[model samples]
Target: MVLTAPSPKIRRSATKVALVVGSVLNLINQGAAILGPADISWVHVALNFFVPFCVSSYSAARN
Candidate 1:
């Protein structure tokens, strides 16, 4: 079996996802400082999960 490299599009998508996740986490941390952990909402949970899920799915499907 031959090993291949990921395509540019996939790389870009993954990087973008990483950036977005970082930014979101930063906001969450900031909010938590003021509001505490119990303030997490369903929308935040869904975005934290499904955003990464879709990015991973896109990369895997392309490969």
Candidate 2:
């Protein structure tokens, strides 16, 4: 069997894409809270920061 390694450029590009997507989702979640009912704001807050932080940390560690 042969093993292939990913190039550094590819790794960096993937990381950047992940970070951008996470950031966009985070922003959307936060924005949603502005128009949503007060009771649902907490949920948005949690999703906005918690999920992104977890994904970002994992991506950073991988790099």
Predicted model with the maximum lDDT: 1
Pairs with steric clashes in candidate 2: none
lDDT tens digits by residue: candidate 2, 1-63: 012124455446556765676568756755655566534456655565556555655555565
1-63, model 1: which lDDT tens digit per residue? 012225565556666776677458647755764367555565666566557646664755556
Off by over 4 Å in 2: 1-27, 30-40
TM-score, per-candidate, Cα-based: 0.43, 0.40
Error of 1 at 5 (Å): 19
lDDT of 1: 0.59
Model 1 ranges off by over 4 Å: 1-38
lDDT (0-100) at residue 25 of candidate 1?
Answer: 67
